[model samples]
Target: MLKVFLVEDEYIIRESIKKTINWAAEGFSLVGEAGDGERAYPMILKSEPDIVITDIRMPFMDGLELARLIRVKLPQSRVIILSGHDEFDYAREAIQIGVTEYLLKPISGATLLTAIHGVAQKIRADQSRIDYRAIYEKEHAEKLQLERTDFFKNLVDGKLSMSQVLEQGQHFGMDLSAVWYQVMLFQVRGRDLAEAVRPEAAEADRQALEIEDTIMDLVAVQGHAEMYEQIGDTLCFLLMAQTREELQQTETSLIAKMKKAAEGSDKLLYFIGIGQAVSRLHEIKMAYQSASRAFSARFFSDCSGIFRDTDAGFLPESDQTELDLSRLNMDKLDRRIVYNFLAGGTVTDVPDFVRNYLTGLGRDNLNSLLLRQYVILDSIFAMAAFLKKQGISAAQLEQFQNQFRNFNANLTLDQAETRLCQCFDNALALRDSQSQQQYGRLIEQAKGYIDTHYACEDISLSTVAASVHFSPNHFSSIFGQQTGLSFIEYLTQVRMAKARELLYCTKLKSAEIAFQVGYRDPHYFCYVFKKTHNLTPMEFRSQRGAKAAVTGGTDACG
Candidate 1:
């Protein structure tokens, strides 16, 4: 509920105004009352009331003075001014003080109530904003915490042998013999959809978790299995099966269930990759890596389908011949050939047939990046044709042609193809190096600044950029390239990492932690935490605490 305060010199007027309206019905409480603006100022600051009602003229200090102070100190609070005179001068001064309503002293209950309702509505709206922010912050913190723990677990488990539980326990921070295991991969597709759904990414992530839970529940009816969704968008299920065939069958059933749940979503479709059965807990990361790679393979084929690499005809034999594009000595000529082939195929079958011939040469050895470039060029050409169909001038198409030619001239296909396997890596490094030089310092300095300032509550790209003497736009671009994360993403990651430390090491309330992490709204922090880590802050803390205790006990016993 919104809290309200009143300041009036006249006792009878103040009392009447306080008692006249049903504050509760209007969604507020009479937090305090003062006879003068001077007396009200301190209380206003202390109570942090959402609405302040004061007479225009009061002893010691007038309503205008109180309003001004409140505007400066607690800008969120709404102010209403009451006066005996509805003079132009009085109203003008009230307006200067940021008063929402200027009312005459002899106001009716209805008039007063309307003003109260207005203030109440403002308060409710502000509260909603605060609530949402808090939820997001708390969730964000939790997600980070969960991800950290899960990372450690996976790393330790990956290194351990089946019978080497004791050694793994030291690394995983837990006693794992009794704990069940399941691995889940949450795959997020659709670049356009990911961009569109960025704001609601947290909710989408929660939905993914719900999907995992559903899968587990369905599979639990058959046998004992532990399920875990990893940080990267994948789900892993680990459990004992009577035989390899039984595990495969269960995996098929699980995939079918997941597909049904993911189908028909507005923004995203699900593709699951189930790994080969491994009884050893230590080999979980290998399984996870396999599933992750399998999931990525879906992009090479069709969308919205489950794929198991171990299944028949999923992936071709490792001994498949390599596509020898190396024989093409003419750099520009080869690219032109590939581009024309893809473009022609997009238009008819000639391009597709060429691609098939290339595919047949090396099903396993084909360059996916080169293929993507070909696809993009093809789409660009197709779009040019589409524009022509829409009556755009040939001149416009010529401009595009010129631009493409310029871009192609600048690109060295021979060098690109030579480094094709390391293209992403080289591109990332080049991007980062240029960004660091542009920022005029090591990227680590910027990261350190963010780490120190993340809890400022008003921290943003503009604010940080200004501090570093760079424009927000420039800083944002450089930061993304240098850190491989957008401005907000980097800040959130730093805050989340801090939040994880706090969750594991401290007993601070989630709300307090939210503020500590620079989020004024705890709820929003939680939402972010959960979105990143797939667990609530409290849940994460509890889980970590339990693991720590288990590890500590084991150590003491040893």
Candidate 2:
């Protein structure tokens, strides 16, 4: 119902108006009545009525003053001016005050009701427009965000010319005219890092996503930087400033805010890398490249923190100038590093893992042909052994070995790094591929178990998941991903399918069919059958029977 407030100095007139109209029956509510504008203002503020009807002359304040105050504070409230004065100035003043209606004294309730209804219609229309715009902006914002992210990616990858970048930037409301810009990359780690050893780490990925969203919110509220997802698990921030010093300040504040956000979740660890500030728009690629190099340090570093491009390699230039065999602790160059990384690491971890593994072998010592050969051979042996344990085909292992047969000591560090990254990338890819195949087989096993036992009313997700040797949570996630249905949903579908088959081919009552399909309650089965097929069990059978008769075919159940 539309709310209406009445302000009139005459007590008898106010009472007469209130009693004359059954407000509720007319789809209006007389929320409050005030004798003057002074009292009406506060009452109006409280009720927030859709319409305010006030007389022009009052004891303390007039209707025009009340309408003016309401127009400022409660602008959505429509004002109807009831006046005894018929002068043009009074009507003009009411119109100037933005009054919805101006009526002379001795007005009937019917006129007031019509004016109130008109204002109510306008109010509802305004509200509907506001709601529609809200929905439209939300959907459009999501699409625009995706487009903007793509533009940012192309901007950094040097795929777009400076003119194109600036034009598109302006179209997106981003001013790309800054003098200095820097790229920063940050990654949030949750239980995902531990998932290799603990496959049953429930909700780990979900927690990491929540943490990433929170960190993104922090960056968004900063108003000094633009952030977007660069790739899986890594978020990129492009900070622009008028000067390099300002850029540095923004980077520091951004890192601090991000760290603070991550601090809220004990399960989350974050690493941030800030690149060199560049002046030209085209130089953004260089900045991003540098930031990515620094970001890779996350795989090599001992703990979560910040890093820069300067922190890439081990040993200073002075230390690398001499062959320091005495300082080269053979224990530091453990082949277990390769074994552990291959077991737990992903393809993205290849570059940094290779760099760090080589760095640990002593850069100066690696210059010796014998030590270089030893390091390369040791890494290959470890890789091949790990793959063998994973059941890689003998032929594929031979191919892997033959591919690295040319890895000689004469290769430069750059060449060696490239070769090692390729080797590890292939090994990790093969490992993941085999793991997927194994999961496919496991899902098939689980499905077979479900198909056999679905008739048991006591069967459940835990029981079925256990039959296939999987944790309930992990099984639930994989089941949905593989079959596009939850465990319960799939089970229900199997039961319903069987129920339909029995109903069509067997002369069984509905209750017996329900029991045979694992449903204990006949009424619940009927309800579910109707909800799923949009017809009751009896209705469906009758319809099918009628079709059979029309075709001159006998029902098997009949």
Candidate 3:
């Protein structure tokens, strides 16, 4: 119901108007009444009514002044002028004050009722448009975020040339031009969801997501870095600065924020790998590769902290020519280190893991042919055993051994490390390929569910994940990895696709189409339609019709 406030000097007129209409029955609520504008202003401000009906020529705080104040403070409220005099000046001033209705006094209550009804309908329509725009803006923002994610992935992946990167950066509103640039990979290492119990794993995933969100928020607040969410529970940030020193400072500040974000959560461990600062866009690939190598340090160290390009390698303290075997740390040669690394490492970890493993065996000891051969056989058998535990057949293990049959003590430490990296890389590749098959099936199931239920308004990440019997966070990780889009982005894609088909092939109005394809607000639906296709529904339909007419095919539905 619309709230109505009244101000008239004559009590008799006010009572008569109030008595004439039963406010409740007329769909109006007569909230307050005053004898004059001075008395009415405060009451009107308090009630914040939708309609203000006032007598124009009052003693102080006249109708014009009240209307002006309302126009400034409560612009949404409509005003009606009641005047005893039929003067041109009063009507003109009322119009100037933006009054909804300028009624000469001695008016009946029926005239006032008609004016109020019109204002109410206008307010409802205005509110609907406001709501529509809000929804449209939200969806547009989400779509832009996903597009930015893809752009960042391509930017660091070296799939785009320098010119292409700059052009695409411009399109996405990212200023890629910088004097110095660096890439940082922020990773969340928590409980292994596959090995962890269900409830505990889900809780940890939730906490990890919250921590990541906090770090992302911090990065956004800094304004110099651009952060993108990646698959595998990682955040990729591109930090830009005017000079190398400034870039170093930016990296330091961001790492502090990240560490603070991880402070309270024991279950949520994090590592940040910052690459070297470079001066060109194309060099971002080199920076990212170095950052990734640094990131893989966590596999060997199993510690939560920041790593840098210098931390990526495992070099001996001195040249092997001056190395002392007497000072060798036999503890580093423990076979469990290699076994543990193999059990929980990725292909990216192979190089650093191999270097660290070989260095631990004593660089000087690697010169003794017997010890060197023992080390090689130990690593080879470790890989064989790891692959076997993963269910590689005896025949497959033999095939794996065939690749290394030429291995001997003739290899230098560098050569031995290189060969070991290759072996670990192959084993991890096989393991990942098997894991990918399972992930592929889960993703397909989730996508199928989303396709089937895209028209349901309640469809969401949680709902789709539940359908596939996975936790929401875990599903989110794999969904992005497999599809390159978040759950919300994928759902919007499905809804928009359906909306497009309806707009092109059917005679339904946009609102009806919105309802049929999961949007509750028709105006919002139209807004997203325009944003996605650069044309409103009607415009798209007309464009399609024009094309069909040119081609001598059936015209699209009007």
Candidate 4:
């Protein structure tokens, strides 16, 4: 309540004004009433009322003099002078003495109340400015600034629990009890190289502050939002809202005004990424992370437009936007790509596999740039295993490790994916080159054994591989690469060639030829013969005999 003191020489006027007006109802309290300014000054000094009302023509001392004294003693207090028509000059001098208002007498009680109410408002405004000035000054102190910056950064990083937040927020001058919050990440973009460098960095910082002030001005109009902190180039905001819709309305207005203000400078382009509303203060960190990635996505989206966590698909699929690793299907994503490549699958599907990973995370609204990187890193073992199977040397493995170690040097999604794909490509290329060198000779030796042993009924991949002192599995792999056929397929072709030769040259019985050509079963031989040439072995022989007879010539063999 505004405290008001009355100083008037006429007892009837002072008593009438005091009795007729409801001072409390008019937002003021009557501290004391005096018969003259001389006696009132002492009472005014004791009460130190926020507002004063005085008659210009008073006994002993006058209103103008009292107003002047009040100005020096308590500048925050407001003075209202009541004067007669003849005292206009005195009222003028009283105004010069810093009186808030000068009203002529026989002033109505309503008019007098209006004068007091107006003075009370100015007095309160003066005090409010002092309070705010002190707050800002204390917050700007270097020690407090550092502590506040670290506390807010850690809170957003999920390094602080709710209890810790409550404990530390008080010291930082934050009312963390406002549990409901929404966050926004604003990134000033498209800065030229010159502006980004040292010579213009100060200007850039100044412009950033101006932009902050403009945004704050818009927020002040709405009266619900507050500036949180600036996280590097991004300005973070923590808005206290009672409902999701209220938060959205506040954000929409803030962004529109900000965009218009930014249009004043083409170089001042910016984008805003808004997070979903959270119910508790501790959840602000999750909201901030969501907004940060949403802002990053603006590069591929509307670069200068406001994007929400939902709009950018930067929050989890559920209403719960909190970060949790369990919700990520990274294992499923890993399987889609060839984590274990040498176990024999092509990585031609890599790009699509990565696309799926991106889609899944976006759909779930997971802020996953770092998560994607970790997925790539976690597959280091797969690359090592592929290298070991290919017989990559210790030196080669070290060289490959160097590339993977530096893979995260740049963590943007595209840059990181490119690095990961390059690693896979290099490793696969090396594996192929190594396989040709290590298995090429053993494969040739195995082929030579198969050619000689075509008539041996027990000839098999294992038997031939043992003759060349190679494991069946190892020899099979080598044979496939060198001959474009498996060990079993190459052996079958060799036996078939020998069977066809016997049928044409010796006029041999089908069963006898089949037995000599590594087939213990004549029926199986006839089936293989017919399938290979579209005719049984006997039919092949008869057709050739007829052709020889028709030509009136002896068989070519004879």
Candidate 5:
């Protein structure tokens, strides 16, 4: 309720006001009343009323002076002045003194009530804005949650530079210049294929998060761990320990506690790949990578156990006689099978394609289980990154995860293979539902827009993406994927292609050609043209009659 104070020099007028208005019904409390400004000042100050009504002409201090004093002492209070003065100077001075309402002396109760109601509405609005700010701040704080797995993933994946990482880490007061840290990667298997098709995948992602919460909650009590989520069905955690023994003890505690937590849960099963401890903060990424690689161990699918990369027996003796394959043994899979699957192949044998890929990977390490898991997770990340840039989002990735069943203590090899295949089928179904045409059309439209507008100096990725009704980021990804070129590359290609035609066919100077091709800075344009075509405008024009060397490939397409 608003607290209101009344100060009037006229005794009859003050009593009439006090008696006529029902302050309670108006949502105001009549805390105090005064006859003169000087006498009322201290009382109103003591009462701390939200609103004050006073006469401009008084015995001691006038209303303006009282208001000026109140403005300093209680700035939030609203002041109303009732004065008979018709002088322009009077109203001006009241307004300057911050009076909210001013009325002539012969004022009606209804007129005063109107002013009060207006002030009340304004006060409510101001209060509501204040409350909204408070609520916004709270929600913003919630966005800074400790479990920002995506941020950590980016950090480990080398997406952020050291300075960027440090600057972001500073917002949360994290000092990354630590002596020792370990990365924990957990690969979880969810319930059968039928159960994981939920809206949020709250059930599948839960397996990793559950172990994460259990370990982090306990370790947080001791201030020893920080964790973040990464791509795929994995969560990465960094633990800080001063001593090797403490690190070992912490890992042992985490393993034991997490195992106990998942004892009866039939919906989920998980195992952690613990990376070797590293001394430098920058080396933490290496630790994470090692942990990520460790998740591929084929021999260790025991019930929610912890395995460290530093363990002597963790990796079998290397045979190293075969070809040094690519990231996560992609070389193991037959190119045709992998390409067929990736090219939106038939769903009937999609699992076989995946299983064939898994079976093909070996590097003297006999741990087929670990190798298979590694390849699968790595393939998801790789394929997602690859497909996302083209616009066919890895929308099926999560759905694939739902159907994917990796090895677990409770599952046999045949059961694992069956589930893995089921996962692929599920993935194919989701992929089919979202055909390439969704973002494909957008990319085509974007390219056409760029082609039409390339000569405009202001043409940019954001503008082109906007023309196609997609975000710059999404447009960039899809544009890159569809054309096998980035937005900038494609845009530059179009400009250069036009510039080449202009250079070869017309007599325009380098600068004019540059301008016509959307290259505002001629020297910069020369640099880019040289970079793209290995020839300056003059050189390219000179070579127009020579064997059209750079004109046959994507160089000509651009």
Candidate 6:
């Protein structure tokens, strides 16, 4: 109900007006009545009445003053002036003070009711606008958040062609078309130590953000940069440089900045991988793939610190070198050698081993795989040299180099069988060490938390971190690095997964399931669910002959 305040000096007039006006019927309440404007100021300020009915020529602080104060303090309030005189000057001054209407004294109920209704309508209209603006802001914020997740997911999935993804990104409010982009991948270690030492997950997240911001700031001083996503605990950045030279300079500067950021931070070590430049959107995914592969080189610790696929030296040589094995048509022979060695058998003569083993295989059997391994082994030694230059233990590199040499020197027919088997065992062990199950345990913990709490409306990175005793910032970085899924995407996936469960298990209404799964609005839940799952809740349930069940199955209505 709208509240109205009265300020008139005459006692009889004030009481009569108050009693005669059917305020309840007109959707207003006469919250206060004062003998004069001076007496009414405090009451009006306290009640904050939506409409004030006051006499113009009262004792001190008349209607004009009251209206002016209300305009300043409570601008949404409407004032209606009641005056004994209908003088042009009084009416003109009342309008100047933003009085909505001037009612002559001895006011009739019908006329007063009309004025109150008009002000009430204006209030309702104003309220609608406020409500709309609030909804718009909320939806806009959510859209931006989702777009960030979608962009990164698409890049990783290789589902949409890069050009199509970039085009769609524009619709989602990202402008990448005219930007010069280079991708950087970060490989993070020391997750266990970081969590053990820093109890606050939010603080860890803040530190990560600070690191990213610092890197971006340093890059910005030279050129523009935009962080694409934090994949797993690693941060991926797409930098825009003015020229090839600038890109190289920026990469060098970023590497230095990141090393500094990681230094002295307990349990944090950084390995950065940079990709070749790509001018067109269609080629961006290729660049990202290159960077991703470079980042993975941390597992080998024997490749270039920065691997650019565009570098001719990094590419496989087309011409067959003496060591190429391309012309040897040795696929069957190589596999046999590797298998025998892995099975604990051996070859005796080096050159004789190759020629005799491959004698029966067709020339067409030759492929790039054998040649590539040869190139990679060569690069591994080169990487060991680079690491030594950077102050790494020479013994470590020398150990690996010796192994490579042993495998090369034993190229005789008999030893080839043994060396290939040894190489197979070593490669398998390396791959096993980098498996998702081995390195992704912490990420699984975070994901488990998400699966459990995604139904809470307030579920977020902060809440998840709190549950695990991590700062939100640290959790975000670590979780991303471990799972390659950002916090929001992971959460959304959890929600959608639960929605699927509900759709299959019971007969709860779609709206109820939406609320049960932490989405307050059923319409929005349906929209997001369909976007993720390609079917509305009901449609999905229908197709599977499954029904959404309530928590207890006591009330489908819920």
- Choose the strongest candidate by TM-score: 3
lDDT per residue (tens digit) for residues 93-157 in model 2: 88898998998888887887777778887877677566546534643554466568779879888
Q: What tens digits encode model 1's per-residue C-alpha lDDT throughout 451-485?
A: 78888866666667656644343455556556767
Model 5, 200: alpha-carbon shift in Å?
A: 13
The C-alpha lDDT values of all candidates are 0.60, 0.77, 0.78, 0.67, 0.65, 0.62
lDDT score of model 2?
Answer: 0.77
Regions of model 6 farther than 4 Å from truth: 1-125, 155-166, 186-223, 230-234, 241-273, 297-558
Candidate 5 lands at a TM-score of 0.39
* Best candidate according to lDDT: 3
lDDT of 5 by residue, 157-239 (tens): 66777787777777765656565778876645554222334554454554545555565566556456665544233456677
Number of clashing residue pairs, candidate 5: 10
Model 6 clash tally, residue pairs? 30
lDDT of 6 by residue, 1-558 (tens): 889998888888888888877889878888998977778988888999988988888887788888898899889889989888979998898888888889887778777878888878887767756654654565455446546655765754467776777677677655565445678876444333213224654465556555655655565453445554453455667765667777777777777776776555553445687887877666667777667555543432322144444432222323332344444553443332332221211121122223323332322222234543453354344334433433345565566567766445425433443454454344334333333453366577777887777888667666777676554544665666676776777777888878887876677999999988977667777878888988988888876653333333432324
Model 1 — TM-score against the truth? 0.35
Cα displacement (Å) at residue 215, model 4:
2.4
- Per-residue lDDT, model 2, residue 211, is 65
Select the stronger candidate by TM-score from 3 and 4. 3
True lDDT of residue 104, candidate 3 = 78
